[model samples]
Target: MEQLFTLAGIAIGSSGLSAIVVAILNHHWAKKKNSSGKLDALVEAQKVLMIDRVRYLGSSYIHDGEIALEDKENLAEMYQAYKALGGNGHLSTVMAEVERLPVAEKR
Candidate 1:
């Protein structure tokens, strides 16, 4: 009877050990999946913002050259585009021209 009880205890202990190991593995797998999804989202957002900054910087340069600042609606459109695209990049010191632009003409 004593031997039977000892064998049962060993079996239970091994099962518990396996359960703990499996739980740890599952936790690591979940974290890896979540981080992968976040990384993909960040990359996509960066791509969009890069495009916007490049486009705005080009248009702003042209407008600055072709006469006095005409209508700021163009600049406003650019600012919002910048915000959507991620807004991190900036143009050359020349692009300081963006601030000179107003929200819109008084109409």
Candidate 2:
């Protein structure tokens, strides 16, 4: 009877340990998956910011030809960043259209 109780206790302890090991592994895998997704989300956010900046700059240029030197540099940087992050060609198209628009004097 004493040996049977000891065997049963060992079995229960091992079962609990197995469950803990499985939990830890599951948590690690989940964290790994989330890390990849989080990076993608961050890149997507950067793309959105750059795209908006490009649009705003393009519109300002089209309306008034009022882009400052700093803004022009920023537009170029944003375009490069957008392209690096898998942006479509919409920004290039918009910029081309803006270029074709007649320049206006700044108010």
Candidate 3:
């Protein structure tokens, strides 16, 4: 009877320890997942902002019918970054149009 009680006690302790370990691991994973989701959201926001900037600048330059060399260089850098962030082909068309615009001579 004493041996049976000892075995039961050991089983209960082991199960309790297991439950605590599982709880800790679950908390850690949940925190990690939340952080990963936040990072993804931030990256998506950045991509959207970059796309908007590229579209605005490209459209403005196209409408003006000319772009300054310095401005064109800046636009090119922006476009490159946009592409790096997985921008689609729509901007590619706009960028091509911008490239065709005449460069304005500096005063």
Candidate 4:
């Protein structure tokens, strides 16, 4: 009975230690997954915003015509937001295309 109790105590101690380790690992993984999810969301939002900006400008806006001052402001604001969200410096294709659109000079 004494040996059995000793064995049981050892078993319980090991399990408790293992449980703490498992909990720590779980927390780390959860934090990593959450950060990944947030980054993915930010990228998606930036893509959508870029697409919308292009659509708003149209081909004419791309060629000879200039984008409205408001459009330019919105694009800058969105790009800032994207950067804040940890976007890479490499511009998205849509973003590059939109950047070529001339902003109307303030008179």
- Top candidate, metric TM-score: 3
lDDT of 2: 0.81
Candidate 2: 10-residue stretch with minimal lDDT: 97-106
State the TM-score for model 3.
Answer: 0.83
| Residue-wise C-alpha lDDT for candidate 3, range 1-107, written one tens digit per residue | 99999999999999999999999999999999999999989878888888788889989989999999999999899888877877667588888999999999789
Ranking according to lDDT, highest score first: 3, 2, 4, 1
For residues 14-60, could you state the per-residue lDDT of candidate 1 as single tens digits?
A: 99999999999999999999999999798677767655665566575
Per-residue CA lDDT of model 4 for 1-107, tens digit only, reads 99999999999999999999999999999999999999998778876675565445454456656777787667667666766766665446545666777778877
Q: Could you tell which candidate, 1 or 3, scores higher by lDDT?
A: 3
Alpha-carbon shift of residue 23 in model 2 (angstroms): 4.8
- On TM-score, the stronger of 1 and 3 is 3
TM-score, ranked from best to worst: 3, 2, 4, 1
Question: Candidate 3: misplaced stretches above 4 Å?
Answer: 1-7
lDDT of 1 at 80: 56
TM-score pick, better of 2 and 3: 3
Give the best candidate by lDDT.
3
- Against the unseen true structure, what C-alpha lDDT does each candidate score? 0.63, 0.81, 0.90, 0.72
| Runs off by more than 4 Å, candidate 4 | 62-107
Off by over 4 Å in 1: 1-4, 58-107
